[model samples]
Target: MRAIDLETQVLAAVERIRKGEKTENDLIECKRAWPSNNKARQLAGSLNRAAGDAVIYVIGIDEKDGSIHDTSDTDILDWWSQIVGQFDQVPAEMVRHIDVPISNESVVGIAFSSDRAPYVVKTGSPKPSLEIPIREGTGTRTARRDEVLRMLAPAIRVPAATVLESNFSAVHYPPLASAENAANDYRREESVHAFGTADFFVEHDGRDLVTLPTHAMDGIIEVGDLSFTLNVTPDWFQSETKAPRKEYIDRQREAVLISGPGVVPLRVDVEGLLLSHRKLLETTNSVTVRLHLGILHTSKPLVIEMELNTNPREHQLPEDLNRWSVRGK
Candidate 1:
């Protein structure tokens, strides 16, 4: 995410939020209301929810009582810093990026990305605080104990079956198959029997067969038949396997190659899988598995070539195998 100008920055930030791609939190409209302790606390709370990746922007003119008020305060920077420092007293260190202009009275932007672990914003006496992470719909909420624990837990790699069930809905590709049941045989299946879950299943109507997961649906690209299953551990969960061996395959570079101009090569070295069991954040049950794939050049339609294991985890639930219990479901 690169911002060439203020307008571009704002637009890009909003786009990321809408696409669920934002790594940090973001706020619009700054300095409308006069500064107060409560306002400061609210700002701190928003920053905290970002989990070290958050940005806030003060937009447009401040019109109060139907009058345009020009902000000419030169000491505004110092005042803002003082408010941010209030969080440190609660034993939470907040580092933010500040950008203000002498001529632009309409906009102010504040960006925060904490390098430290989770920070809490104190609200009342005895220090009742709220943990921070980008909220799904309303933008940040006080995380419950279980949610906090899930985030703090060590990374583990487990099978998908341990958490998810084998059930799915289907769709067809290409406009020719857009009819009610045209090409409906091109079906896919989604299984909750794993660590991280995926949506968008394709069901086969004729043979009653379902295609394996594919990158077209999510990050997964199926390589084999549905009957073939692997025995692997779920990522980012308490598991018996401490370290798992890396699996490699001969992937066709053309199928997953990315190319473009002005693109830099980037590499990610995933140590352990970063899996998330998120409920209420989205419309469906989701599990995310993080893995480190080495560096590659940045290109449009980024291509990834790898074989991933799709296996059920070692755990079982009392519900139907097709449906697994999820939060906010």
Candidate 2:
């Protein structure tokens, strides 16, 4: 019942079908190449036959890479409305339509429930019939008439009052003691900063330029005895600058690698390092060396900021400082 993106959801649906978790015939693919009205009607008919047990999902309007490109000339909201109307003609059915955003594309999910009688689809010149079964797979036959009837059969609805409830237990919770122990024992914080070096060479250029780290400008050498190394690309750098000669502004396109004792190696994007570097840079005009660490997420990357000041004139700080420690507002 959950609405999902067509590209991602379709793959899941396919997985379910392949595993026999869900019937493959229940899925349908509608592409922009086909007639929209005809496809809509076919989908409507399929829904009617299954009485609301069937789910019709759409895909392929977006590009093959699953990027969203607006195709329909009409308003999407209006088009969705018309799609619902067409399916509503099916008798004794409740249809639920949902629009899911996947990447740059929009995927529509239609779930139909038939609570009353057998669903029927109206084909050209022929009256509504129950023979048209929902297809579960490519080259697979539709559900048989008897099988469809069985699915449509009205079973006694179980009352919630009759269902037994069990007491909840905290045993399923993640061990708090283990987490607390880890937090208490291994407590060290670190920060990172990303700076562009002119000496770096470009490997390739397309959407983003691939460059290499230069020994002269890279900031890791400044962190004395903290024990840090690049976790991502040791030699290569991804440049975000569209034009090479543009003024060196601290943009979010740069990424850096970082690793140290008790800290997991990570690749952090430029933005994360800047946020961490803000305080140090603002406080002192004297150039302080720092390592830019990138933290990769499911969708994006984050930067960790660590500072190293080796100036003999300035106050010497503790060697084992916790970089993860946050100052409270």
Candidate 3:
């Protein structure tokens, strides 16, 4: 699934639950409070039943009536980490929690998929056994061997990855577009860069100041004829960097709408502009001015500055405009 404004998404999803618009399914489960004791084991079991689908466990809401519980004392992230580690070692990116205004507690969202055959529960002291957990109606039970082999069939059919040891094409660019290999149109060609401004929003009730455009965002501005595009897709190419061991990461996704910000195109930079009084390179070096708003996302205000960098390079400039557009090596 595409990354969304976590804070807004969590709230909207929870709101749907409250209004009876959405309910649990094969890929979703809801919890009432922080998972502890037996609840933690049950949490692991639910994840196992997900079977590599986009599964979510909306925590802090009553499964029966969708009542919101106070979360002041429950630290969602800390609790999430403890549960994931004790039950099954899932990647940090796979499961995450978001805080909502509905309650002091936060809601958790997990998008998990695995090529590995069986994801099991660890129930032992030293020698832990891998017992594949399978979904049986409302709950989960250990999977039978025949069931597990079915799960592992895909991984066995293809090598997980192909290692390229020598010469390489540009990592950012896609491969050849020929009869054998098809190229994705949206990704392969360079996209036109959209320009905009960004502002910092701070809470009036004594809170931290933060950059605005990244989250709960809204903007409007008067400009020439222009249309906005959602520049959300990332390059499909993966870095070839082979690393040793690993390192530490402190980056985190925001829990609440400290603010929710997203991009909107106010105008388009095209041939009509008076750039050098000519429309020859109208598509190149064309500036599309957009407003980087704040108060809409949070309880704050913003001011514009020209000397400061107002260029929001959320997308790449056209291939012809880019300096490195020179052909050949």
Candidate 1, residue 37: the lDDT equals: 47
lDDT at residue 60 of model 3 (Cα atoms): 69
The all-Cα superposition gives candidate 2 an RMSD in Å to the true structure of: 23.3
Per-candidate TM-scores read 0.36, 0.31, 0.38
Q: Model 3: residues >4 Å from true position, as ranges?
A: 1-16, 19-22, 88-93, 101-117, 124-130, 155-329
lDDT (CA) for every model shown?
A: 0.33, 0.35, 0.40
Candidate 1 residue-wise lDDT, 1-329, digit = tens: 12334455544544444455632323343444435544555554454443333345543333222212344454556656666655544433334433444243334444444334244555555544433442443345666666455445432211111112222211112224345554475433222222223221111122211112112212331212122122221121223566883312112321212121111122121121111211211133332332222212111121222323322342243322212222211
- Descending-TM-score candidate ranking: 3, 1, 2
Q: How many Å off is the CA of 284 in candidate 3?
A: 56
- The better candidate by TM-score, 1 or 2, is 1
Model 1 TM-score (2 dp): 0.36
lDDT of 1 at 220: 36
RMSD of 1: 18.0
Give me the runs in candidate 1 sitting further than 4 Å from their true place.
1-7, 11-35, 59-69, 88-105, 127-136, 150-329
Cα deviation of 285 in candidate 1 (Å)?
36
Greater-TM-score candidate between 1 and 3: 3
Error of 3 at 244 (Å): 48
